[model samples]
Target chain A: MACVDDKGQLTASARKLLETIENNALTPEEIAKEAALPLFKVRSSMRDMKSMGFVTEEENGAYQMNPEASKLLKK
Target chain B: MSEETMSQVNSLPRIGSKAPNFEATTTHGTLQLSDYEGSWVILFSHPADFTPVCTSEFISFQNIYPKLREMNTELLGLSVDSVSSHIAWVRNVKEKFGVEIEFPIIADLNKEVAEKYGMIMPEESSTETSRAVFIIDGQRTVRAIIYYPLSTGRNMDEILRVITALQATDEHNIATPADWKKGDKVIVPPANTAEMAEERVNDDSVECIDWYYCQKEI
Candidate 1:
């Protein structure tokens, strides 16, 4: 997990992906394009990040960075 | 099949071994591995076309294409998809992401290249390739290989960093430390003999934690 730490917090890749999703509600493909990550990676990371409350899935199935992730990114 | 023949067919190229050559159809055109001679190559494989993860990986690879070219390297993507599937997927990616994927993508429908590279891990998926990366030098030797499970995406920054580190080591005969990026101090190869170790003790040019571990500016 290049984007996660031992404490289960977001690191480089996770943080970058979150930043890409900050204001934009995007599909996995869109997120992968925006974040410059592989689509498979974005899907998997989003799953983990979402479960950790770092991101949220909208009714339309797009993803957005949650408030918790924003705070962590700010740091 | 004999054990020896099976091993030869299934085994992946080891570091320092010659990269197996192949000719295949790509989005750009038909290409052979030998065509990339005299340039470094980052040969990678994805699971499928039009899939989310593979799409993102392609986009990311596109983002780094320029940097790789600047380093005298070429990017070649591959999958078990057909040439038509690869073409359609490329079109979709360009139209959707506004990214033009300029690299060639090998359509390994027959799984010939996949078999040679051992890209398909049956435990993960019988039909699809796990994410695999092979870095080959200008001389066509396999320099580095990285593999990720079907679900995980690769770290683009790390990929670039590794290429940089490998090039640096080849040029300067120095090794990188953990999490080492460009401009960071590199580890000097340990002294080979006691006499050289004694000479290394007084070498003021580098910061030595011990005879075997020393750091020096590039």
Candidate 2:
């Protein structure tokens, strides 16, 4: 799940999850389906997204977007 | 070298001021800034046509064009590329992307318009224009300006946020706070007294963070 980027060596699946969430909100299953990654991998990515402070999961199980996430999609 | 440097330094346009007028051949025809007299203007510059980032940005803008027009705002896209290049790109946008960009895209082949707007920044691009956005009011005064680095694309949401903020400030004579979006709380200017702040928080619909920091729904 780790890889090197121009920015740094980071988690590959996490980066993939960030890419998926950049365009739209998705649950773990939806992220797995869209990314073609495994369920565990998607969960890992979601965890990474949380750690990066790019997304927040609401109590209702819905995910909320942050300003950084919005900016990333635009970029 | 000093004189050349000074001249180059003097060439950049200042933001929050009057946008210089220019005439350029667009997809629709020749366009002048004066023609959009009674409407707000979103004058945006792109790096190039037929590119991925530019394509997505154009499509997104076109998709929201109707909403923008409803706000009495007109869009004017610009790049240093030629008019034919722009036309082909517009056609491709409609045919391939299924989005129509009805707005006129200014073709500044000579970089005249680009230089006038400080769109041609060598630090960002030596051979192309950078992603620059300018929001001009109905009176043709620059209200807000933004620039994106070459590797980064501009945010349509942030663009619209700035426009909405400007409109709100003009309408209500209030100021927007950091990361302000539509329907979010806006800042109320600091009153000299805590009593005034408490009164503001209690009397206003905005959520009060503290006595000094009062926010209201915009």
RMSD of 2: 19.7
For model 1, how does the per-residue alpha-carbon lDDT over B1-218 read when each residue is reduced to its tens digit?
79986886657798899999987877654567876776799999999999998899899999999998889788999999998899899999999999999888899999999889988998899899899999999899999999999999898998999999999999999999999999999999999999999889789998899899999999
Q: In candidate 1, which residue pairs clash?
A: A38-B56, A38-B57, A39-B53, A39-B56, A39-B57, A40-B53, A41-B153
For model 2, which pairs clash? B206-B216
For candidate 2, write residues B132-176 as lDDT tens digits.
888888888888878887778777788888888899988877789
Task: State the lDDT at A31 in candidate 1.
Answer: 84
- What lDDT is reached at residue B111 by model 2? 87
Best lDDT among the predictions, by candidate number:
1
Interface RMSD, prediction 1: 14.1
Model 1: residues with Cα > 4 Å off, grouped in runs: A1-75, B1-5
